[model samples]
Target chain A: MSDLSPVPASAVVRVDLPQQPYSIAIAAGLLDRLSVQFQDVGLTGKQVLLVSNPVVFKHYGDRAIAALEAANCKVTTAILPAGERYKTLRSVSKLYDVALKARLERSAVFLALGGGVIGDMTGFAAATWLRGVRVVQVPTSLLAMVDAAIGGKTGVNHPRGKNLIGAFHQPSAVAIDPDVLRTLPAREWRAGMAEVIKYGIIWDRELFERLEAAERLDRLRDVDADLLHHILTHSCRAKAEVVAKDEREGGLRAILNYGHTIGHAVESLTGYRSVNHGEAVAIGMVAAGRLAVKLELWNAEDCDRQTRSIEKAGLPTHIPLALDPDEILAALQADKKVKAGKVRFILPQHIGAVTIADSVPRDRLREVILGAMGNG
Target chain B: MSDLSPVPASAVVRVDLPQQPYSIAIAAGLLDRLSVQFQDVGLTGKQVLLVSNPVVFKHYGDRAIAALEAANCKVTTAILPAGERYKTLRSVSKLYDVALKARLERSAVFLALGGGVIGDMTGFAAATWLRGVRVVQVPTSLLAMVDAAIGGKTGVNHPRGKNLIGAFHQPSAVAIDPDVLRTLPAREWRAGMAEVIKYGIIWDRELFERLEAAERLDRLRDVDADLLHHILTHSCRAKAEVVAKDEREGGLRAILNYGHTIGHAVESLTGYRSVNHGEAVAIGMVAAGRLAVKLELWNAEDCDRQTRSIEKAGLPTHIPLALDPDEILAALQADKKVKAGKVRFILPQHIGAVTIADSVPRDRLREVILGAMGNG
Candidate 1:
């Protein structure tokens, strides 16, 4: 981690989808320069609806509105309730009301301003409102900036399952301001590292090694600016490259769901109360690593190395002791990715490489999950 | 008008979207061959959810289920209430429940078997189910068979407006069985002719002449079987060709909204109660024709010809007396096609062609709408 060279002023990663190509701009202090950025992306002189939650709005909503207005764009605001529980069709319905009240037209722009929940709901609103309009993502959390915001996978959860209802409506642009991390809660900042670590294990080896070289990975305040910039830019670039090749998750894009299979199961099993997304993904990655080792897809040394990285980021490396492994397995079977009645897993072959394996024996899955629980 | 000899075994109109190319099959007795057709489209041996309203299901559900089962596909049925009012997110939530209960995976197929309402809701469900799944539209109503079923536009109505929530998710296949029309209500069957007339006025002059040649265009039983098949095939082919050239309604496809600009407003102002979709579109086409004639964009002779054609089809050519002209204008301003505060209208240039006009003077619009109400 000794490379202390100054990062670029703003790193741009292009998501090259033929239908609606867009770019993610990673930079420091982008909120103030949002008007310029949006103008650069062809969003000026348009009707823009800025959607955010109360918490996020209190921090940055004014800046976003001012930026858009300064860009000569008409701006309207819809503030939704905060939390994962609020990410529902009901909430999205409220956004539609605001859009209609504001008279948002087909060419209007809906700017999502907040974390994954806000971005997902706003993007979905934009996707469905008037059968789909343009949406620009302004992710205010590390979790969203690196992962959720970059991809156009926008949706709200159903009572029965997570992301059971959604549309693959890509955003016109994704503008990330790293300065927002300073205000993000410590838990959310750590939750984001889980995804950054995920990029390392599945796609980028140098990123994996850098996390290992870092002295501390507990909070945003502890991480240097240069490393944070690199983490944000590299992770966005990796996700962009994968999504560009397979925009609809037809084949190559499923690799991005490396930890999400078990991770989503864990989140659902816990009723989304105990573990945040990043924490659940961290725990899922640990179990996936163990499963990879048990299936002889990867070595124990690589598994242990992955576990240490997860722990270093202050993320949970195991499932909660109270949760039943069988229930989790049931949830896994019901996951969207389950095909032909078989649960598919993206298992690591080594650092920075993984393979999608649906052939993992059911008995081995039970063993690895139970082992991750520290009991059998 | 005499070209239709036997109307091929099944006329196939390919919607050539590069990302997800699909076909719309128009046939006379295709309902009995549903299983074979679905299998031919790569839907065999998979989990299929057949969504239909109780009314349509009462007549066709058993056959569809039997056919799918015969093809060795696992089939689940979700019977919703029959009405445009029932097309809401809540109804879609019921479908999500059915999908989850059926354990529908990412590869599961959702087959819509009803009118436009059922097809729209079902397709919307398919679009959002696990981010997106394969959908086969089995349109029973003539309106759906000709217009709604051919386009990939799927949506549900919001309290604020009609079709305010939707996604552009193309179907894997659209199987139109003309035999089902025998059971369609007289009102719905007539409503569909408005769209057929629209295709004529916008792109097909021969089709317009064919309608003029028909003796009676009021009811399905009154129309000859050969002409009915031609209407279904020709209309589907026209829509497919337009959607193929512009899948997203970016430029060339806006012309498809010929009567929809004012038609949708009339539907919304009526609370979607007083007028069925085709009736409102019929009225809007009358008003649009008048507007075009008043603006000198189209001659009065062509406009009167269009009115006579709509009248011949048993469609209302005048706006409902109870609807306020101002309210209709306001609703038109709120339409999805309104760009930059201007309501874009697809005005006719002649019998078989139209042009997009956003510069229609407001006073002239008011005069034409009032004239259509027989008050000017």
Candidate 2:
């Protein structure tokens, strides 16, 4: 948005919560040099609760600890097990124990390090410990730093569904260093990219074009870091502006769920193991677009353009049998966004704009599912 | 603050979290009459996840199920084991499993219809489920309705320490009916009364005098419903107002920990079973008073009055030898509130006013402990 110039490391994307307004920082390696950053945010050397798992602890814990220590700030660690099931009340227990062992005061800071799973569980832990703690996220994975880390949405998963248990506890500051993704596996990297691309379809088509042109553009070998940074900053700003206006997903915020309703059902039915979050969302996005087209909100061209982009990024674009359209429809019955059991949508009319509506009829919904499956 | 009117079949204390605040309604006959009151809060028919243990569920679950059904709301049940240990990830798993079976959506609510343990664990489960869902507490215990139910705080205890895992998740509405306490044991009733009496001494001398005049305020039997409602409202208002201003407890909220610093250490040293929260606070308050006097921050007369009041409430006014003061201090060193490892105190200068200062010296802290044990 600012002519692709590298912004200051302190450049922040704010999510306005009058009770606790927060900012998200996206830079190449902010975590390695984070001591000074904490000061600008009014966060003095208070105790910080660092929640992560074994793998992430080994990779980034020591560096985080050193950074805090450099600033003369105290930090403690709670390394939980990795995976989705571990993102439950039980895992929160272990985190609580560690904080208790550290004697975390109500004013202590809770930092989440690692992937979406770690951030989710740790954020939920912070959301509840002593009613709540000031949470700061140091996301180590691309999927986490770009998507999960930016939103104040934090929670553990109920076995019934992914992120079935959670809170809207926003972070005080998010120290995101995209360089952390250098060590991530190709799959995880791609999963995060799916979300990055999502920003293009939902709010800014220029982002989509840039992402589509990356392969032919200058940066090579790995994903273009500059391109990545630009996308990250813009996407974060987009969500931040909306979140600032709609702290809770009550109105404008719901449009950000461009691909999450059916995506959540897919994740739940598969128990979050069969598909990575982005892949499920990729499929869900396609399905939602088809539904929009069926309802005459958008034409087939919009559907094809979006699905092709997801496919080009190596993301899935079709719903699987793991979830039946009927079941997803049923799950929608209880969505927090539903007013009187009607499913809501954040569907695109074209590449440049999206619509938030609940006008899709039942028969049209069925036809959309069938069309999305290319089945009838 | 309002004139007594036969308790109105219930007493509702509104804890305003204007940013995301919900109300707490403490009443009688809530189990049979929740449907009507819930409608007053913008709540209509929706799925309800009733979380409780087998014992309480057997007695009240059927009635809950019947009530929700009459209102045409879908209902599901998740039963955890009846103990503190079950307040782990394992227990939350049961809730998740049931919620999944019922296909709970974001609008779904979890009803915690039991005592403190159930209320805490269930509240946490709701807080994390789907990142957050509405929690409607129907506290059935005197301890819960008077203390746990009144606060928006919800969490589970960790094996390492009590309330190590939790969230400041306010229930969308707390349906508190004092009639539920009829089943509580005498010991249970007495435990809850300690907190009731505590409000009078630390903040309201008038409430203290009233409790002192009661023949069995500690036992909590036949303790005039209106007086109890008055006591409950005063304490809740104090807590709710603090929470409204500082939901995350940054600075001004620290005074709420008047006796918690040392009391927490004592509880940790003795494995939490040694004392209930109110019991610990009773002694901690006295200890804090003496320390305040020793530091010349509080007058001796005020400390004497506070001590005598605590003693008269049938609460412990002395620290126990079950733990060494050194070990207690070590644990205090880990408190999230401690800065550079020095413990702080909320010392009262007089009734109705207190100061949160960390000027207490370590040698003085040790001496205060010695005096609390009658060694001075």
On residues B62-129, what C-alpha lDDT tens digit does candidate 2 reach at each position? 88778767766777877778755566656766777777677777778888888888898888777776
lDDT of 2 by residue, A1-376 (tens): 3445675433567777676777787766688777766786766678888788888788888888888777767888778888776777678777777777677777688888889988887787788776677788888876787678876888765545456567888887888887776667677776777777778887788888887776632122355556666777877777777778777677777877888877776677667787778877887788888877876878898678777777767777766755677876776665545555677778888775789878667787776665555210
lDDT of 1 by residue, A70-130 (tens): 8999998899988887899999999989998998888799999999999999988888988
RMSD of candidate 1 to the truth, in angstroms, is 2.1
Candidate 1 residue A71 C-alpha distance from true site, Å: 0.8
Measured by DockQ, the strongest candidate is: 1
Scored against the true structure, residue A137 in model 1 reaches a CA lDDT of 94
Clashing pairs in 1: none
Go through the candidates in order and give each one's C-alpha lDDT.
Answer: 0.88, 0.73
